[model samples]
Target: MTMSEGDLAVTELAFVRREQIAPLPPPAMTTGPLAWVRDNLLSSILNVILTVVMTALAVWVIYEILDFLIFTAVWSGADREACLASPAQPVVGACWPFVKERAAYFVYGSYPIPERWRVDIFFAMLATGIVWLLWLNAPRRDIGAFYFFVIVPIVSYILLTGWPLIGLEAVDTALWGGVLVTIVVAWAGIVVSLPVGIVLALGRRSRMTTVRTLSVIFIEFVRGVPLITVLFMASVMLPLFVPDQWSPDKLLRALVGIALFASAYMAEVVRAGLAAIPKGQFEGAQAVGLGYWQMMRFIVLPQALKITIPNIVNTYIGLFKDTTLVFIVGIFDLLKTVEVSRIDPKWATPVTSTTGYAVAAIFYFVFCYGMSCYARATEARLARSERR
Candidate 1:
């Protein structure tokens, strides 16, 4: 169609100029570190005030901690005298020398110095197994699980307590104290509670009336009582019910008590996870003609456990810390060993108790923090796999 003269003039006037149509960069207010700072820390006046206040408080805390832990700390000393300042001087810091000297007692307890290599070897094996299990893309995980679940426990028991048939001197359970006892109790509780808890959780969901009732009763009863009561019952009252000829070791009693207590709590965590699973999952498994156990094994539990990883780890951390309560039943754990060391006249300085506690706190923090990190990593991995 031919255009009128007026329309043609208007079209020519509306034509774009190429030089005036260049690409433009993002706004300065929406890019780079400065932009991020503005959007986050300085987004509002209140945020800016909070950020500055928090930063200053953090700096002050860090400086104070570093000053106390490092600046005036005594690195090497012979005894209480070395840790103390002369009348002419004032001192305030950790007596690290006592920690250094008593390190073996804290780690091995009364474990014989000659047999300490066994503990070292067991720890090495534990580290290897944990690394293998937790490492992403690791090989032969099945073999690693077998070694961890079966061979390691058996071999570790023999090594730690010795084997007469193998011509090794036996170490009494009474001599087991400090971190050695703590680890043993905590690990046993963790390993035993998981399977037991799973069973209880399954039982709680069972169609059988008796099974569900019993599971409820047990879970409620155990969960209702304090852990200290459980420990006392296991240590004191449990012996009365058994035959006089059959005596259980103190460590065994503590382990059983801890395992049972932990299992009760763990069962609830597992049950919550199970409840979160959609009914469609169970129905889907049933649609394929899968039996009850088969459906749970293949579909329900895997999903449930993945969902409950955080809660499971939390329970485990609590159980690990609870191992310290064994001290009430006359079993010396890490904290108990520290307390015992503090009473020793040789190392009795004003700072001895605080320093010992600090050491114990560091040990506990390292282990608990590792577990937390593993939980986070596992959760991230599972989330990625689900996205895929």
Candidate 2:
């Protein structure tokens, strides 16, 4: 259609001007604690109700625990009678006096009074070495690692068992029990299993048929059996394989069983991590002319191990807790020590058993929680490094 000449004439252009750009604040509803409450606790009607219920329940539980553990608990007493409720003291709580009285026995078991200092020294040195290794800013981390991985274990063993060549009186392994034995078994399993697991994992993925087959068989066989069965076999059946004149210490046998059992599980965890690495990583290493071990060491393993830190720590925690199973083999670990201590007629109160177990639980929790926290920190650090 054509526009008529009379319809409309020339038009003038219109323009609008801005004085300044304004900055806007974030929504008040999406900041601070109130925002967290809105997003997490009160996101929906059901969430609000659940959060309220859980919070109230947690508060009640915490209060009850504190009341039992502290408010009405007897801290000073000689025996069970003092821990019990009487006309003079109607309130009854945890028999902490029993724990305090037998603290040494719980720690060192029957490992003679005079030799206790050796255990103490060993703990001090171990703590020092750990502090040095984990200090972050501490000097000579390589030296600290060497001391921990090499010298500390040797010195610790010598100190704990005593070196007659060095004029120190020997302590019998039979006398070792309680937390001392538990730490030994757990630490040994943790330290020994990692390398064994790595080797098994590598073998499982090896190019050679025999190596792969043997690795698979061992891993499957061990993983198929319950830990208790392995422990029983180590304690009972292992002696038959050795010469009559060559008897292995029961503790050593238990350590072997625990280490082997842990290694199988650890190998699976490591294998998962190795599998997660892209094939390109391996190809890249090969393209750079790196040999198998060298490629794994400098390229593959560091990444794989970092990825597996959480699983590795979980394995360590499981091994630590399983040390309690040594009780079945007549080795007095922390749990066994507590059990034995609670049976004493002198301290046998209604609360003694619970108190003893609570103490052991606290010890286990602290160690496990520490490992978990360390794993989180390490993961975060590695993530940040990768981002950079």
Q: Which 10-residue window in model 2 sums to the lowest lDDT? A: 6-15
Q: In candidate 2, what are the lDDT values of residues 303-327, reduced to their tens digit?
A: 8999899999989988898898889
Report the C-alpha lDDT of model 1 over 79-183, residue by residue, as the tens digit: 888788777437667888899999999999999999999999988998898888878679999999898889889999999989999887999989988989999
Model 1 residue 291 lDDT score: 95
State the C-alpha lDDT per candidate: 0.91, 0.91
User: How does candidate 1 score on lDDT?
Assistant: 0.91
TM value for model 2 = 0.92
Give per-residue lDDT, candidate 2, residue 57: 100
Reference-based lDDT, residue 330, model 1: 94
TM-score of each: 0.90, 0.92
Candidate 1's C-alpha runs over 4 A off are: 1-49, 87-89
